[model samples]
Target chain A: MSERAQQLLEIADDELLLGWRNSEWTGIAPFLEEDVAFSSIAQNEIGHARALYELAGRDLGKTADELAFDRAPEEYRSAALVEPRFVPDWARTIARHYLYETADQIRIEALKASDDAEVAGLAAKIDREEVYHRMHAEMWLERLVGEPRVREALVELWPKALGVLGDDLRPLLRERLAALDLPEVEPVERGKHSGELAELWEKMTVVRRSVPGATW
Target chain B: MSAQEQAFLEYVQGGGQVETSDWMPAEYRARLIKFIEMHGNSELMGVLPEREWILRAPTLQRKLALTAKVQDEVGHAQLIYRVVEDLGKPRAACLQDLIDGKSKFHNVFHYPTKSWGDVGVIAWLVDAAAIISQKALLKCSYAPYARIMKKICWEESFHILHGRDVILTMMNGTDEQRTLVQEALDRWWGPLMQFHGNPIAQGDDPSFSWRIKSQSNDEARQQFLDGYVPQIWELGLTVPDPKLRKDEEADRWEYSEPDWAELKHVVTGNGPRTKGRLQLRRTSRAETDWVRRALLAEAA
Candidate 1:
């Protein structure tokens, strides 16, 4: 695969895994209204993944489904930050959402100027959807900002959030922290999968692999 | 009814709407909660049957569509329960009552879905049938419920298109694939027919008297038939009701009487999959109890 295809997969795999993680809250979120709002965010992430996969698949001689589900656990390029199953925990979930969307906004803005028109175009489209996601995550962050536990959760997850951005992207992400007056930490950049990735991969692909060659 | 009740009845009788804070008779309040509560419960329980498919969906398109459909159901539950919550019941209490079987959900969700065929048929005809009743609810006497219905109806529009797309793809595929659609439709027709509930005359129904439902049970069922019977026939899938027909003369549909007794039994927590579905809800809730406590506890 070309350099473009590999870069696109990293983004797609990150989103696909994170979207899958977020969806685990569909029926079991903290409350009903918030559950609805959170589900939409999950759908948006998956939708972003689909669009990204389509862009990458053109160069890889495959379809989005093949890219999303046909890969082995080790082959997936998603970061550890998005691979955990953190249902029922609103603080951690919201923390991760805020962190990831913030990190994603940074990366997507950079991609928006890609030489490849299709990749750049898809990034522009996804950024539109991510705006709502950022607003939603910020809403919860503001709502819970006064609480000690929530504040602690946000602090604990900050480094992992940094991990989502690249070494060079760290400068931009650091500026975001300086604006918030938050203390900086070592960044957890992409490339390494978490221990959680294996478990996520098993469940994520179980159903797809169940009946090989049969149409859904 | 007394003079005041009689006057109130006349207002709704002539198509009046009520808001959450509006004055309502004791009977109207009770009936509205019972009726609307069941709908909220139905949306919540409804997620279980369809959610499994999200885990097992064959293709990327199918997976995303199925996930969105299920996610919309969760969103609908949120929208619905809020209406019920404003009606004097807390959502936590409603959920507790649901887990305890003190409340009810629709009968269709209480049954099991066997294969991908069941997924397509339920989304196609079941949601289509449901949208007929929900469309009627857009004009419900209660204002808050009615407003939420607008959003609910808008979201459901996508489910129908998604359902139709799924079923159509299967229908146009292999012979076995077509059979899946046909067989699933055959099994679902009886439940879909009985879904709208026993027909009561317009004047005799309390929900209609207070305009909680702008359409009668039979009226909604007829609308479903009038709108969808032709759609079904075009797919070359026969409904289980052999007597089904559209009398262009009456501009209405005719079909065999649904077994009202069976509907009563199934919806009252005795359906085939009711126990198992409820058990799943209970288990998941229990497992996740800490999340609510962790957040709510902090709030408290």
Candidate 2:
């Protein structure tokens, strides 16, 4: 794959997996208002994934759905940060959410400066939507600041959260966390899949594979 | 009724709308809270059956569509609970009543969804039935609820289309796929038939007497039949009611009397999936209680 296509696929895979995980809370979020708000964020993530996949699919000679659902588990390039099932675990979920959105904003900002106009333009659009996500994350972070569970969750997920970005972007993530006064830790970088990803992939693709090539 | 209550009733019956701040009879306020709270509860409970399918959606589009549809239901619950809250019932209390079996939701949601075909039938037929009733609610005497119903109805239009598309794709596919739709229709037909509740004289129905519901239960059921029975038949799916037919002379639908007893039983929190669903809600709510407190707590 070309570097550009690989980059797009990595981001797309991250979003698709994260969106799927986030959606597990649709009907069952902590509160009704939060359920609605979080579901929108989940949808937005899936929407971003679809758009990214469409861009990557063009270079890979496949359709967006083909790129999204037809790939073998090992072929997906999503980082491990998005692979865990955190349903019914709001503290950890929000910890990951806050961290992921912060990291994503940094990555999206860099993409906005890409020489490729399509990538840059798409990045700008996605960054616009991420504004709300960041606000939501910050809102929870403010509220959960002194809570021990949230503090503990942030500590546990910090390394995986760092895995969401590339080596060059990791320093930026570290710098952003420094503002929150979170201590630095060894980063759990990409290039390794959690067993959770394989399990999630099986459920995600079951129905599609049931009637292969038939429209759902 | 006192003269004050009588006068209030007359105004509502004459198409006057009530605002949240307006003086209402104690009984009127109580009934309004219960009715609106149940609607909110129903929307929340309705999400459970379809949520699993969002995970197992066959395509990216279906996944997005299902997620959006479920999200709308959650949104509707928020809107409705807000309306109820403004009427003196807090969202927390409403949720409490629901979990404790002190409240009720719609009967259709009390049952199980066994297959992908159930997903289609529900979005298509069940939502079609609900939209018919919701359209009637656009004229509800409670102005806030009526306004929210407008938004709710608009979003629901897409759910029906997405549902129909799913059913059509399956019906037009292989034999097994078509059978899926047929079997689902057969199973869902009973609950769908009973969805609108038994007919009562509009004048005698408190909900209609207060103009909170602008149509009788039978009228909503008839509209559902008029609008959708043909659509179902066109797809070669049977509705499982042998007696179901439209009476051209009276412009009414005649069907086997839905088992009111069953509807009563199920909605009273004894449906096949009701207990389990409630437990799921309770467990999830308990697990996340701290998040609510932490996020909503006043700053120190």
Candidate 3:
């Protein structure tokens, strides 16, 4: 794959997996209003992934859905941060939400400076939606920052959150964490698939794989 | 009825609407709460069956669409629970009653969704059935619910289109895919027929007398048949009912008597999947109790 295509897939895979993880809270969020609000955020992530895949598909000669779903779990370039399930655990979920959006802002800002106009344009579009996601996460963080469980969740997931961006972006993520009084931790790098991603892949592709070569 | 209560009934019957500040007869308010609360409960419980498909939707488009559809149901539940809340019962109490099995949702939600075909059938036909009843509520005497139904019905139209798209694509594919739709339709037909509840004359039903529902149980069922059966048959899908037919002479549909017994059994919380779904709700609620507390404390 071209370097640009590979880079696109990496970000697309992250959004796809993160959206899938977040959507698990659709029906069962702590409250109804939050449930609706959170699901919209999940949909926005998937939408961003689809647009990224479509751009990458041009280089790879594949459809967006093919790039998104047809790959083996091992081939996925998503970071470990998004692979874990967080349902029924609002504290951890919000921790991941706040951290991922923070890290993602750094990644997206760099992409917005890409030489390729298509990539830069898409990055701009995604950042616009991410504005709401950031506000949502920050709102929750403000509300629950004093709670012990929220603090513990942030501390535990800090390393994985840093892993979402590259070394160049990690410094920026650290700067944001410092602003929030979050402690810095060692990074858990990507390039490895967790068992949880495998399980998620199984459920995600079950119906599509049931009858191969047939349109859903 | 007391003279005052009779006048209230007459007012509602004469196209009058009630707001939160209006004075209503105690019985009307109580029944209205129960009825509307059940609608809210159904919208919430309805999410369970569909959310399973959100994770399993066959393609990225399917996945996103299914997730949004489920999200809309949750949104509807929120809107409905707000209406219920204004009517006196709080949202938490309604949710508590639902988990306790002391309240009822619609019967269709109690059954299991066994396949992707079930997803299409539900999004297509199940939602189609619901839209019929909801459209009647467009004239609901409670103006708040009536207004919300307008939005709900608009969203439901998109769901039906999405569902039809799913079913049609499958039906146009391999024989195995067609079999999936047929099998799902067969299993769901009975519940769909029973969905609007047992037949009752419009004038005799209290909900009708108060203008909460402008249509009777059978009228809604007939409308569902009139609208959907032709579409189903045009696609070469069987109705799964040997006796289902419209009698043009009477302008009504006649079919095998729906298993009223099963409808009763299910809505009373004895369907095949009722216990498990409710238990899932209970467990999730308990797990998230602390989050609510933190929010309340922050607000205070």
Which candidate achieves the best TM-score against the true structure? 3
Regions of candidate 3 where Cα sits further than 4 Å from its true position: A180-184
Docking class of 1: acceptable
| Model 2 lDDT per residue over B126-239, tens place | 999999999999999999999999999999999999999999999998777888899999999889989999989987899999999999898888889999999889988887
- What candidate 2 gets wrong by more than 4 Å, as runs, is A181-184
User: TM-scores of all models?
Assistant: 0.84, 0.96, 0.98
| True lDDT of residue A174, candidate 3 | 83
RMSD of 1: 3.9
Candidate 1 local lDDT, B1-300, one digit each (tens): 888888878887787888788877888888888889899999999988887666556676777788788888887887788888888888889999999999999879988887688899889888988999998988888888989889888888889888888888777776777787888888888889999988889888778878888787888889888888888889878788878988889988889989888899998889999999888788777865655666686678
Q: How accurate is candidate 3 locally (lDDT)?
A: 0.93
Best by lDDT: 3
Interface RMSD of 3: 0.7
lDDT of each: 0.81, 0.91, 0.93
Per-candidate interface DockQ score: 0.35, 0.78, 0.89
Q: Model 3: per-residue lDDT, tens digit, A74-180? A: 99998889999989889999999999999999999999999999999999999999999999999999899898988999988998888898888888888778866
lDDT of 1 at B257: 88
Residue-level lDDT of model 3, residues B1-300, one tens digit each, is: 999899999999999999989999988888899999999999999999999888888888988889999999999999999999999999989999999999999998999999999999999999999999999999999999999999999999999999999999999998889999999999999999999999887877889988998998988998999999999999989998898888999998889999999999999999999999999999999999998898898889
Superposed by TM-score, candidate 3 places the C-alpha of residue A205 at a distance from the truth, in angstroms, of 0.2
